[model samples]
Target chain A: MYYRSQYPRDLFAELDRLQREMQEAFDFSPSIRGLARGSFPAINVGGTPSSVDIYAFAPGLDPASIDVQLEKGTLTVAGERKAAEVPEKSTVHINERFGGAFRRVITLPDDVDSESIDAKYRDGLLHIAIQRKQEAQPRRIAIK
Target chain B: MNMNESTQVAKAAEAARNEAAMLPPVDVIEDTGGITLYADLPGVPKDKLSLQVEAGTLTIEGEVALDVPQGMEATHAEVSLPRYRRVFTLSKELDTQKVNAEFNQGLLKLRIPKAEHAKPRRIEVKLT
Candidate 1:
């Protein structure tokens, strides 16, 4: 899904490729990261002893319009944000908000239990939690 | 059900205190009636969001709340900050008193109507 087309592409797409290359060369910290022109929605994935948490930040979307699916330890979040209406004779100044179909795929760690997953959308963020299997959980051992 | 509300609130507060502010994406449109501004602020609830206008300046701020489980460690993370802040200069011709705003699904829309004098007026022709 991250692959680019071989044929002609838009100027924005070429710029995105350049941005990706810069990111690779100088892995900037997310705390002060710059805009990623290619990716529609930003996501964060983390895990604990019990479960793993995934968050997708995509605003201006209806909860029902989103589709969350997990198969073979790969989680995919897909959704679309309808474009805002621009009245006739109106002048647009800045348009940085994303408006289109977006999809993000992430592979979970081996400890995660694929079946035990819960996903919810609220406050323009999608949160997904997946439990880890019993054997995969960390346990303290007694030194006797 | 597993985590308590108070603990989550405390965690959110701590996160907000430690994190740095990031600029949120926005769209601005102008029409005859008013100017409409759309800001994307995911993970920020209504209660945590604030809009302020002072001395011809508008400020948008919100603290994002991240719900981390009891003792979860982050194996991977893209963004850990929970604060978003942006300031804009308000035009003198805009009617700040009548500014209207609406928030839905972490998106904020603000409309600043044109001042009465700033609006276009049609004058009647005098017949002698």
Candidate 2:
């Protein structure tokens, strides 16, 4: 079974590499722009019968700087991560964190109630909850 | 490849990928006082963070906890829930004893002070 899985895994990796090479060949700019696509803050969206929840993984952000906007059924979270101040006359060894303006958009289900949306930031994570419309919720039918 | 060999190879590849993925991005700044390191570890609470210095090496580990409501199904997920880990070698010129760390909103800030000998000194001229 393990041997069988390896073949497909290798094939997938080969295809992925080829796709990346083709992208590079067609585009002169770097594939990952600062805080773009793969580099943007990641998010998770889940829903229950009552409400929809969104968890955004954004560390090193000032909660006050974060901006949340809802339009139609789309929710956008925008913020800027400021760069740390490096003292003068000091040599920098490594820097991997990307800092700049970032905007993440999530489309909520049509059943969500925009007026009942709430968001909070804590411990470097942003939580957004939107209540589901009462009519859209699942209901149990009664037998006569 | 045999089943056993293939399993071993797959395990090795998985381990390598996890190591790469868990490496949290960091920014190291050096000043006259010492060097400061900043690491971005999202979703890690203060209590779940660990920092230690042993044998001139500094290690930072943060566990990210995701709270999912019960009976809820995830429809879309782009973020991964992986613990953050990173290590740095401290030079002898740094005063490890005076090292201090502060965490706020998922950012870890470490301040390592410079030893007396590492600081710049001025020599006073004596009248002949």
Candidate 3:
């Protein structure tokens, strides 16, 4: 059953890539500007024996402005990025940076303890650590 | 062929390699004073960043650091750790000597002032 469901998911992903490529081919502006439709605030999630760590890449954001929350085995990072203000009498040649409110939700493993979670933002990256529950930890068994 | 042509070709090849790694998004704004460039380069620290200008060409490079936890494997991975690099050609009217740079939260800001001759000036009226 698992192998059967995997085929269609891979096919759907391939089709989505094709559609995006076709859109880029038709739209000459993005190609000329060399811009790709990349997602905002890219993230990496990994875990250790006792805890799970999530790293979010978000530049040009104030650390104090970001809000992190965990509930129901889901972690959410929300924040706003302000647009750069152009000076008076200055003409803008090219404007490409996007600024606005953004929120990213990540579903964590059920073994994580809801009470032992810590989050910190530093050097344009947000790091979140969630401890695993005591019951979920590995134990050594002795041979008789 | 001269040395300049060979160097140009080498630069182009380096740019191609950079694009394959990661292309950092940028915004260029021109004002009366000069041009301001803003680039989004997350996960890159100040020490790992590089900025260079030569023969009216500006280049930026940054290395991203990824710290995975010890003894843990990633079951689901989406983000790829790639270095950031980009280049831009500048006009002769801009003064490279007066350029300024600042990095905060992995965002790079470059300010290039316009040359004196390129700036606007008002001539005083004289009676004959």
Q: What are the per-candidate TM-scores when only chain A is compared?
A: 0.72, 0.71, 0.69
Count of backbone clashes for each model? 0, 0, 0
TM-score of chain A of 1: 0.72
- Alpha carbon lDDT at B61, candidate 2: 80
User: Which candidate leads the pack in TM-score?
Assistant: 1
- The segments of candidate 1 whose C-alpha lies over 4 angstroms from its true place after superposition are A1-38, A140-144, B1-19, B122-128
If candidate 2 were superposed on the true structure by all CA atoms, what would the RMSD be?
9.0
lDDT (CA) per prediction: 0.79, 0.77, 0.76
Clashing pairs in 1: none
lDDT of 1 by residue, A26-92 (tens): 7965322333323767777777778889988888888888999998878889988877779998999
Better of 1 and 3 by DockQ: 3
Between candidates 1 and 3, the one scoring higher on lDDT is 1
Candidate 3's C-alpha runs over 4 A off are A1-37, B1-19, B75-78, B122-128
Model 3, position B98, has a per-residue lDDT of 95
lDDT of 3 by residue, B85-112 (tens): 7779999999999999999988899999
Question: Residue B109 CA error for candidate 2 (Å)?
Answer: 0.7
